[model samples]
Target chain A: MEDRVKRIEKALDHFLPERKGSLSETVTDAMRYSLLNGGKRVRAVLTLAFCELCGGDEDMAMPFACAVEMVHAYSLIHDDLPCMDNDDMRRGKPSNHKFYGENYALLAGDGLLTKAFETALSSEAFRNVGMERAAYAAAVLARCAGEHGMVGGQCIDLATENRTVSLDELCEKDTGKTANLIMAACMMGCIAAGANETQINAAKEYALHIGLAFQIRDDILDVTGDAKELGKNIGVDAQNARCTYVSILGVEKAQALVDEHTEKALHALDAFDADSTFLHEFAEKLATRSK
Target chain B: MEDRVKRIEKALDHFLPERKGSLSETVTDAMRYSLLNGGKRVRAVLTLAFCELCGGDEDMAMPFACAVEMVHAYSLIHDDLPCMDNDDMRRGKPSNHKFYGENYALLAGDGLLTKAFETALSSEAFRNVGMERAAYAAAVLARCAGEHGMVGGQCIDLATENRTVSLDELCEKDTGKTANLIMAACMMGCIAAGANETQINAAKEYALHIGLAFQIRDDILDVTGDAKELGKNIGVDAQNARCTYVSILGVEKAQALVDEHTEKALHALDAFDADSTFLHEFAEKLATRSK
Candidate 1:
């Protein structure tokens, strides 16, 4: 792994606690379980990469990295709520509601979402960015996390239940529910490090392509990958008859689309002069990952 | 009625439909009823009062005013959930979950909480405050609404179930969950309008007293008031054996405490040269109001 990626991983590990000793033990545990489960920390890695690529300090981007991960984890918790997906397992273990009960799971998700910004605002990294930049970053995070962003996307996804949706519509749903927050993560790093508008826009573009590509790959994985490899139950989407890129485009065409998105993502990165070998390679590998 | 209070109510009615679409009809309608079913609009009114008092334009403070009300509504929704108070009625009508199913009620609460920020950020009022101020206000609102504020207080309250909590501990929980958000509303308005630290601090102090007094009066009302006047059911605290200020201090002592807090709230207004008559009288009247 690259040093920046390693740094993000290390920071995330350091940031999560086994217990906070509050009354919200089950909620905190649910947060810790998903957060610490050994995913690739893709969002944080991308944030660190983009911040470094923009000739900015990675130290200033660490909180943004953690914030993105917390938001991601919280989304996963809510997505698994009985009202939403009714899923029983996540990351190969009992889902939050399964273990914590529905009410605690709900509160836990809400707490994590709120805590992400609190963590971001209180970070030394934020102080380094100054109040204006910190505020800007918070606003960006809020927009992506709130209704017009991730939650809005979730609303659309829920609305599509038992209905056929076109490929464009699927992309629209994925863009908001999954892609927008990821894009916000990358953009937030740039904003936190005080990158120029040019750098920020380029990073945003890169994030948009990669985020969509990531979801497409996820759709592809759901259809073809084994549960052991994906760390999740495969074919669940097919069971739900949920419209996805894979469902609409077929596996072969979905693979092609991932490649096209990877190319587009790299194209956006071309604007940055700083080395982005890690980012470029990350995009390419996202297409090939089994999970 | 105050012009700003009327304006906030008008805006609440206007923005109510901006969020709901047809699909989530049950959940959306429940949210609408709780939000539109009139209360005093006290928190939003406080926000507007602080902004005008601090020499900030009310127009710039209005979106945030709406946001506070939304947050307040969300707290009520969650507080009345089955695992919590399980209140069937609020403001003399069926609570959100009582009309909607429990599951839909949960989602509706989530939807309203998410919409609060979206409404705030998307508003021209927020933009008028400048990005820096808006971001600060957003952060404040998030902290107040999230675990460290209202949600955290609820968690503690739940933990203290079926037991006696000391006056200090009860105060701490009530203050954090209830007063904290109200304080945030006042501070956020001042910050939104670019109030200096001195003005912000004064408003915060005033908010602290009123908020605690409000909760204390609530406990008192629970014991003394009837079902018709207070709306919802009466004597819920006694029925649930909940630990509240009145439960801990007894009715006479709680009433004395409310008076003390109300006087202190008014005294805090003395720090500012601006006409705080509405805010001062508002606090005093809030203490004695029936229903």
Candidate 2:
């Protein structure tokens, strides 16, 4: 996991614009400051792990992995905007909008999102994946992250704020908001490896299960985790009146859901011939994570 | 021109998500509101005209044309945010943020940008252009819109705000901010048609000239055109303390620059073997138009 994080970090540094460029220093600096702040690199790691498990070249997966992280980072930056989450702190430090004024922070987020595709499209590693597959994968990323997916989920979150939401509504939001990108990561790996449809479908199902499990654990942590370990103010969901797994089902039931989903995630991989020890361990860790 | 506008409108309607879909109604409504609002659709028109001139099927060009407009609309939406340009209206109507609030406005911009690529990638029309060409075209769009192009120009615009800058610096900023996308539209047309490198280069040069001219004319209009004529507030460049062609080089010199660039634009098209009469007329109209 540490090596995976390092690899993702190195690729990100190489892929992002150099700090010395003549472009807007403030925007680029803000972009770098947030992107390189060293999160868990979960999405990138998932991409690489899935690629390796499917017998694809890890080198070919690096660009897509980095691109996923960029998308994730961009989402976070926007999510923390005053007009959005209004978060002053993220990952234990000042949020993007807090650090760079709102204007620069907004443009910085746009820059990161645009750069993700530019990097993905221009990458030699991506070219090695073949244009057809690359286009397909790029399309997947766009669909999963755009209004139809994460953006839509965000809209629903705002629309339902301070309102009681049914479990079904919460599930719909969670699926769109969290599982889409994870599914994209797994699908991208399968595409890069030239995996068959069955393998791709299985991987997607695996991602959905683990993604739900991950989110459930996050909800649990929001109420119980310490601020320092959580790397931001905890109990934000409750304060926002967001309906979460823990809020809807309570902690014990939410934990049970996480366990069931994690088991299903591992079960989804039964069709694959390759060793998936890392993925299994990763899912377990995410399900039981403190932060 | 009216027919071209209608064609662009129809394509956009077909390509954008329906407002009644299950996705967050607010986000999609915001997207449709801003996108379908009666803007000039210049980028899409340029793409279609150039593609037809290059002997590509116009139907096949529609997807890329709509994508270009989506990008343009997204930029306008983001640029009008309170944190950015802070405009209250666009196209004689309430700006996205004014109507939807800043948060939804921000997400709507993101949704449009992401949808641009998704529409491009999923187009059966695009598939007929071939994967390598489609990928190449997509990369061109991203670069023109992303850090290396429009976003970079935006950065410079902000960085140089309230400061005097050289004409060269101003040109560089304009080149990145505006010309890049115009140039991209032309390049994508050529790419779709499988035009040779020289033809593609000529299209780019032509685009750059016209793009700069178009922007210079915009600066002139901002000061002289009525709010009703332009469908938004005028004289904003001076109010914002921003550097523009009209501000840096008075109206006379800015008008002179527009003429020079327009001529240069027509001259660059001499290398192409196509009926360029319409393009010639279009350039003259763009340079001389009141709004």
Candidate 3:
């Protein structure tokens, strides 16, 4: 797992825009700052793992993996803005807006988001995977990250702040806010590997379950986990009065739901003929994570 | 010109995401509100005109044309944020942040930027133009709109606000912030039409000169034009103590520069085999417009 993570990190560094000593160098520096900040890299790892599972070259999947990570990084930057979640810390360090001030941080987020598409579209991987598939993969990333996916989810989350919502509502919010990008990552990997509909659907299904489980686990950790271990302030959701699975269903029920979703995620892997031991362990680890 | 503007307007409306009565409806509405707001569809028109000049079907260029317009709209929304320009009016109406509030305005900007790529990558024109060309066109748009392009230009503008800079520095800033997108529009049109390198370079050169001319004209207008004619406040550069061509070179010299750039822009069109009467007139009109 550490080896895979190191590989993903190296690829992300390689794909980042260079820091030229030009007028716009500050924003580019901010983009690199937030993007290269240490995170789990789960989405990127899933992309590469799923591509290899579908008999595709991991090298071809690298671009998409880095692209997904970029989108995630941008979202984090925006979410931490003063008008959004107003977070001052992320990953045990100052949030982007805190580090670079609001203006450059905002531009940095915009830069990363635009850079994600630029990287994916210009990648040499398209020559190997075919442009049609490459275009489709990029479109999927856009849709998942755009109004109907992550951004939409963020809107809903903001609207529902300070209100206790039902389990179904929480699930709907989590699906958009969290699951959509995970699903995009998995589907893009499958598409890169030339997987047919059945395999693609299976990967998507797997992602949906694990994504939900991951969110629920996050909520649980916010309540019970240590802030140092989590690399961010805990109890933020409760302080903000934000709705979450743990908030709606209680910790025990949330834990049960995570286990259930983990099982479902593993079950979806049955369609793949290749050994998916890594994915199986990955799902369980995410469901039971401390942070 | 009016007929082309109407066509561009309809295409923009058609390409905008539908507003479903979902939790995310407000951001989508914000997107449409800002995007469909009455404004000169200059970039879109440039795209389609160049496509037609390159002997391609205008229908095939519609997607790229609309994509450029989307990027322009998103930039406006972000530029109006309280942290940025902090303007309350745009095109004679309240700015997006004033209309939809700051949070939705930010997400709307993000949604529009993402959707721009989605629209271009998923267009039926890709099938007609070949995936390779389509990908290249999308990459071009991304590059122009990303950190080294529009966003980078914005960063420079923000950093240098309230401070006077050299004419060369100002030119570099405007080229990135204003001319990069215009160049992308012309280049994408040429690419969509499968134009040769010579044709593509010519269109780029034309766009670069006109883009500079357009910015210089804008500075002149801000100083001498009426508010009603401009649809927004005039003398904003003076109000914010921002440095522009007019501030650096005086109005008479700035106007001279605009005329010079306009003539250079027209000269670049000499490379085209097809008649470029519209572009010739477009450059002249832009150089002399009151608003």
Give per-residue CA lDDT, model 3, range B1-291, as digits (tens): 788888878888887757787877888899999999977889989999999999998787888998899999999999999989899999999999999988889999999999898878765656657767778788889999998899999999987886779999899899999999999999999999999999999998999999999999999999999999899999899988889999989999999999999999999999998999999999999999987
Mind giving the per-residue lDDT tens digits that candidate 1 earns over A1-291? 667666766776666554477654555566677777676788887777777777668777888888888888888887887767889998888888888777677777777776676666654644667656776666677777765567666766766767998787788778877888888889988887788888888888888888889899999989888898777898889898888888788999999999998899989888888778888898899878887
Model 2 fnat? 0.70
DockQ values of all predictions: 0.42, 0.76, 0.81
Model 3: how far residue A198 lies from native, Å: 2.1
Report how closely model 2 matches the true complex, as a DockQ value: 0.76
Candidate that scores best on lDDT: 3
Give stretches of model 1 more than 4 Å off: A2-6, A9-30, A123-126, A196-199, B12-37, B92-94, B97-108, B118-127
Give the TM-score comparing model 3 with the true structure, all chains together. 0.97
Per-prediction share of native contacts kept:
0.37, 0.70, 0.82
Worst 10 residues of 3 chain B by lDDT: B122-131
What ranges in model 2 sit over 4 Å off?
A21-23, B19-23
Q: For every model in order, what is the number of clashing pairs?
A: 0, 0, 0
Q: What TM-score does model 1 achieve against the real structure?
A: 0.90
